[model samples]
Target: MSALAAGQRTLSGHLLAWALGALAALWLGFVVVGFRTGQHEADELTDGHLASVAALLLSEATNDFADPRRVIPTSDGDNLRAHDYQQSLSVVVWDAGGHLISRTGDAPLPPFAIAEGFATLELGTPAVPWRSFARWRAPAHDRRVMVLLSVAERDDLAWDIGTQVAEPGLWGLPVVALVLGLAIRRGLRPLDALSAEVLALDVQRAAPLQPRLRHQEFEAVVRAIDTLVARYHAALAREQQLASELAHELRTPLASLSLHARLLRGKTADEAERQQSLQRIEQDALRAGQLLGQLLTLARASRTELAEAAQPFDLAALARRVVAEYAQAALDARHELVVEAPPSWGLSGHPVLMELALRNLIDNALAHTPPGTSIAVQLDAGERWLQVCDDGALAAQKPAPAPAAQGAAARHALGLGLGHRVIDKVAAVHGGRFEQRPAPAGFSTCYRISLP
Candidate 1:
């Protein structure tokens, strides 16, 4: 699988998680606050009502004393007729001398002395507490009245009110979640479309992504994908061009070898001619082998295989070694090969790529220049540059136009080819470039692979 496929994550899943989490948090917060507030309001109303009832009862007791005929009723039927909340409440009236005047309901007696105004009476353990309120007649101070209610009953009422407040949200949460899920899916529709577009892409004919996306969030992503696709297409084109060039380069050598082989097999009367034919076949084979090797090196450089094998080495020493390898070839061509560089200097890069680049440069100089031409291999450690200069008339000439079928060997003969491109690729991978320019004597070409 591609890295892109392996690293894929669902946008809708993330959006849904965040949306549901935020909604749940808000719901919880509202439920807690509402429950507490409802309970507090219930307590306030119940306590205030209790105090008011106690005061009213004391007033009624004072009136009853003024007129004995209308004395407050002690019968449950009469008390029930007097108040709406009488089912959940109890009342008692007492004289100033501590004599019970009247009472109603099954409420327990006060756990403490009757106070003048409002007060709570806990009639049991803290875990199962009951509550009551007492009031004494103010002007006459001749009577006291108390109203009682259960703590458990009051709590039940508060809880009912709180649940009523929270009922709508609790019931509607699933619907809200469904709406949020749909919204998140709709929001991510563009991403799904983009994914489809990417999946339909043909790597060989890939093009930049069109900026037809409506969402701004995906603009950067689409542009990045376009850039990546463009790179893939360029790499593919380079590989195809390399294959074509390799085919073309192999054709001539193979033809020459076949012709020589046929001539040798014809069994000429002259042994010298037969020997020359064999030599020609061998030379053709060697040429083909050399071309193939250079092509392979170019392919490895293009694929970035060399960069993966990079290590620290002496740049100056690598230069000297490359120059030495070509010294014999230079001598055979009657050319002077000279190296000018530092004793030792360190650099981090693929030594194989470096050697291949340097070898290509030296070979290009040798192949293009005359036999007596003087060639110099110069390395500048500080600048991280390697240059090959040849004082041949052809070195001053412009390189021939690239053939339809281009390869390292053909390019070397014309002073520019696959070898130069491979060197350029190497320099680029190392964060630099390959340059060709005029030299003091003829022409100089250089590769600068900068060190970081």
Candidate 2:
């Protein structure tokens, strides 16, 4: 169940998680900033109030000291305070002669020991703390006044005001999350639709996927998927065509071999006829073997993984070895074989597939061309290209490139035999292209592969 849940995790879920995490961090930051701002502003406002009230009380006093004006505004019309409001400002006054004067407000009279600036005082049974400011009247210097503010009251005021401001934001978090989640899910609907389209695709058909969305990313995805599906279909067609060709190519050789074998085994066989039948049997067997070998070689050439595992090898040396191995076959066919390459040319590629391609090219040149044809296997290290050129009537009769064909039989008739097709696939694996060009003066056509 846990594994299934993990697998079910979607893009929208991850997006929503990241967004919520960011919002939570922002909210935490806002709260920290708001709390500090509220506390700092509360302290400053209370300090200013203490200073202004003390100044006002001092200014309102008469020289005779008969009466003083009431500056404290604690008396509400309904005799009730605002919610969370608990403490009133305390006042205390004294003469410079050390005589007590007037005191007002609910808080107890602040002590004389209070200094000229702000101070904290411990008052009452459990010793509640008060913040006080004391100052003497200007010029007269005969009277001094002190105003007290409860520490707890100031803190409660700061927290209450800031909490009220931030409460709605906290309460609205759920609504914001709901909207964000819905937005993310709605935005991802295109992906769900894309997935459905892909799932509905058929392997038997090479239908192109239609672009259902104009989003840049989805368009790119559509293009990529389309390219992939096209390549898959092409590969599948090539495989089916190869199988059909092999089947068709095999029937003649197998039947010829069987017929020649029966003729040799028959009681009416003559010496000369028996020799011809034996020779025919050998040729048919050889043809069948060659057909089977081509099928496997083409299969290996089509494997893309071999290209990724390329290893460095001496290209020129490999060319020399392949030519040497085929030297007897060329002599048997009455063909002049040659190789023109540097002593050593370093390259990286699938050496096995490359050797197969070289062999195919040499075999194809000798098998399809007239006897005594001079075939040259030349490698141009500077250009990173190699070619097999033959001066034969077959190559001269066939143009450099025949018309493009889709079916295997069409390809064979057009001079793109199984061998040449193998070479083409091998070239593609090595990130190269195969070409047929006009041969040099002594040659009729050149089959070439060039690498980047």
Overall lDDT per candidate, in order of appearance: 0.71, 0.78
Candidate 1 lDDT, tens digit per residue, 1-452? 68886688777887898889999999888888888888888777788878888877765733353332233334435445355333367676777777666665545555336555555555643334556788777777787777877777778778877777777778878899999999889877878898898888777677676657367888888888887788778777877887888789889889989987888778553799888888777767777877777678877786555237668898788888788888777776666899889999787777777787788878877777655667888877776677777777653454542343133223235332567777776776676778775575444443344444
lDDT of 2 by residue, 1-452 (tens): 88997789678888999999998888778766776786787778788888988888889756344233543445545664655544578777788875667666656655676679888888877788888989998787888888888888887887776776667677777788899899999998888888888889886788878655457888878888888788889888988988998899889888998898899889998999999998778667767777888887887777644345878999899999999998887776666899999999999888888898898888778766755578999999998999999987753454433223112212222233678888988888788999997788878879999989
For candidate 2, list the clashing residue pairs, or say none: none
Q: For candidate 2, report its TM-score.
A: 0.80
Clashes of each: 0, 0
Per-residue lDDT of 24 in model 1: 94
Q: Which ten residues in a row have the lowest lDDT in candidate 2?
A: 405-414
Specify the highest-lDDT model's number. Answer: 2
For candidate 2, the per-residue lDDT at 334 reads 60
Worst 10 residues of 1 by lDDT: 403-412
How big is the positional error of residue 224 in model 1, measured in Å on the Cα after superposition?
Answer: 2.6
